[model samples]
Target: FMPASLLATGSERIVSGLFLGTALSISSVKIVAMVVREMNFMRRDLGQIIVSSAIIEDTIGWVIIAITIGIATHGRIELASLAFTLAGVAAFMAFSFTLGRRIVFDAIRWTNDTFRSEYAVVTVILAIMGGMALVTDLIGVHTVLGAFVAGILVGESPILSRHIEGQLRGVITALFMPVFFGVAGLSADLTVLVDPELALLTVALVAIASLGKFGGAFIGAEVAGMSRSEGIAVGCGMNARGSTEVIVASIGLSIGVISHTLFTMIVTMAVITTLAMPPTLRWALGRLPMGEAEKKRLEREEVDQRGFITNLERLLVVVDEGVVGRFAAYLAGVIGAGKPTTVLRTSGESEADPVEAAHLDEIEKGAEQGREAAKEADEEPAHEAPLTRRTHDAPLSAEAVAKEARKGYGMLLIGLGRAVTAKGGFSRRLNEVAGAFEGPLCLVLKPAGVGRQMPRLGPGSGRILVPVNGTANARRGAELALAVASVTGAPVKVLYVARPGRDEPRDTVSHRRREAVLKDIVALADRYGVEIETAIRSRAAAADAIARQAGRNVALIVMGVARRPGEELIFGETTSGVLQRCPCPVMLISDARLRRDDEGREALRSGTGTG
Candidate 1:
């Protein structure tokens, strides 16, 4: 800046230097993420730190660039121009994050739910981007600011699932990225570099850009108490300006803030730095070894990647105005935590019922509790608002509920008062509701004598009993139990019932498999920051073992059962025995598979189905 300003005659010096420095100082978040991902470091501590720093830098740089452009357009710095630009940008940011964010979220959600057209959400999102960009232009700033803000808010929306994100990204990658880069590339004239003076100046620009970025990042990392290797990796990671710099240079050139020669130099510097970063960053990261704790954390995250409960995008809760209904809602809130939840109040529950109001309050409290626990356990917990609605137009029916389920729910939870019959079998209504949704289901049942008061599911209540049979369903149940226990501060006991008289061979496949199952559950509990006690019963029957555990200070029994091929809502003998014998409330999680054979239909018509 000093050298460039001194060389200028008078007025152009300050603006030229500021624009030049701002252009050079910018770091590209896209390039940083790309390099980090290529090296499989996205989840590691080093990669996270590097990527986060680049994002912060990019955000701040854009703001500075906006201010610079505002000044450059005026030909010189003026208090009124600076003040208007700063005030407009600040006001826009405040509104964007507050009311604007809420409005956008609601709009996107409504579009997703209301539209049956393909790519409706994507269409709405693009429109939102344009609207926001127009707002920034109206405020006398670049539209990119508004577009950037809109992208952040939209990405944070809970409904923007991985599938939808892929669709959006696919469109952008296929259309926008190439077009933008191609235009930017065509605007630059590399022939300017043929002159010896210009060639030397470009080299100087690259050196200045790289050294400034690397030194700043290295010093900052050191100040932050990072290790030497980590600091080196970060410095290398931050030096890539990549496509962000190209965009910045284009903006500068478009607004007459920079000449074509300088623009070409900036673009050249960007290309060189970006192409050099990945290999350098890879080398630095490879020299850094993972510690035991980091290794464990990585393994836990891997489990989470494949775990059923962890990957659930949204929850569909169908509950009534009963104790069981409220409990189910509370459980749903806990398990779904920061994920979007749609609570469909079963028809026939009075809208003015005090129990219904209480149920809503319980859901909020449960969600808050789960959020707090997540804050303690996760480095970056999601803060998405849960979505809830009720239907009073029609009574609860299989067809109506299934219609709601078609909107892409990860799991469905049902808790109706008449879920069980006098003969201890699942009621006909319960079977119909369960048969409607073809996904995982959680059915909550309140015991016969339990009153209107909510059960103490939190601390001081008792332990949570989760029985794992080494199946995927059983592991899912364990994950659900862990989530509840994490929020409630309750101890969890994993009960594994071994077949009696099994061959007692060490290191056998069956034995190792059992050990592995228990080990996986333990790792899962550790991930939730919850301690669990494991119990193995080799002699007692599976049901008896589970029932006995339920009696020992257990507040609730959560079981994962496979749907049996029958007309009735049967989950095999073990589940039935435990449900009949367990003294506490039992929650069953099962896949949505109903064997609807001709004989099964006749059995249902004859009302001759068992639980």
Candidate 2:
């Protein structure tokens, strides 16, 4: 009984519905694609759930569209037609799932076997997606369902899936997805829900939908016997509607089941849920100390299974003819037992062998005299006997040392000794090596008269001194000290020096701040189960304070250094000053040790010692 104009208008509406449904479906996919990449959800449990739910939402949207078409044709939805359409969809989905999986897997295998080009594999994946979409459209189901099904089919195809995902990610995440969400927001009319009753209704709908999702997921997790915190995490994760909600709202609008007002309200709900997810997830996860077993399992499955080594901690051993250097090299080899080991021998034409030999001869003569004097008299000499002269094929050179150490070590261990007196002379050369070397360095001093059989570094050996200024380089030095302490089981002495006139007066804030800083270092030492003694010294110069303290029973000093611009100084000012004055051997950690972004460290941790 409707007019001819009304019939024509109805026909136009149907056509519009088709276009709107297709566009929104794509837009919804864009939302998901964007969020996934931005949040790096590929490795997250919530991401998996979102992907699965997206599939359901897409499938349901298609079913609703088909029912809407039936309603438009018959002035009401025909139950038989609806049943037939659903049956066809179900059958098609099953066939596609089975056959499509095989097709996708075979294509991946072919790509791997043929050209072995990632680009080609990506092209093939896109072809399959497009083909599947066409077939689904021809069969009267929505294209979104086809895309969802295609994604599922390709999911198991490792080669094609990875390739396609990599290619699609940039385009989808950077441009398409954000634009689509922005457009959806622009299209929304917030004024429609201004009525108090409509606003209440919207709130009620949001509450119901959120509860349905959260409760359903929570129940599933509980039934699976998950921990209370884990169950809550799952529930909070599932409550994020986002892209799926957008797709559902779009479908409702297209089918005339929901008006623009309702669509806007639903969109708002989706945005709220999406925005709430990150904070809620963080809270839930923070509440539960993620079990070690669960973390290990996840790490194994998501990270270790990839077989890509990322984090590696290396130990570099630099050796010379001296007993201290040799011992350090041996200790490094022991530390890097299962990891990579690089043995750096400094030997080159640039290094004069005769000069070093003469110095060693002088030291040996001193040792002989000291020994004779000891045997003859009861009074001890003020200074200890020095080391002997030895010659070998390898000469100490920085480049050679670095090249050898780079083989498999993360931490660089260098011997500390004086070129002449066997105390402060070799520290500058060691610092130069630390600066030129690519990783962290640990310097070990061999005391005068200590034989080839090095004493085991332990609590009885002596106290290890760590000078900290809270710099990243200092932290690295601390890490090296900790590693040494772990090996020797030695107690650590942490010293914080406050330069009297640098900024704050020594009597006021600077002294108190220094105390607080030492407290923090002590706390950290405690965490590692090491004995820590903290001190605050007031001096005009950091080096002076540290040197004066070094004279007081500290066997070793660990200090941080950086390359001075346009200068060939082995150590930074503070470290150099300390080395020049301190009687003990000093370890200088370089800027390279503090570079947190170095992929080398990650590679080392993952058991690759390339750095």
CA-only RMSD, every prediction: 5.5, 16.9
Candidate 1, 99-203: lDDT as tens digits: 998898888888887787879999999999999989888877777888888898998887887778998999999999999989998999999899887888889
How much is the lDDT of residue 366 in candidate 2? 32
Candidate-wise lDDT, in order:
0.82, 0.56
Clashes of each: 0, 29
Pick by lDDT: which candidate is best?
1
Worst 10-residue lDDT window, candidate 1: 1-10
Quote the RMSD, in angstroms, for model 1.
5.5
Q: By how many angstroms RMSD does model 2 differ from the true structure?
A: 16.9
Residue pairs in clash, model 1: none
> What is the C-alpha local distance difference test score of candidate 1?
0.82
lDDT of 2 by residue, 61-166 (tens): 5656544554444444467766766776777778887776767766754554456454666667668888887766666555656766777777655333233567
Off by over 4 Å in 1: 1-13, 291-296, 347-356, 374-384, 391-394, 422-424, 447-454, 538-541, 564-568, 592-611
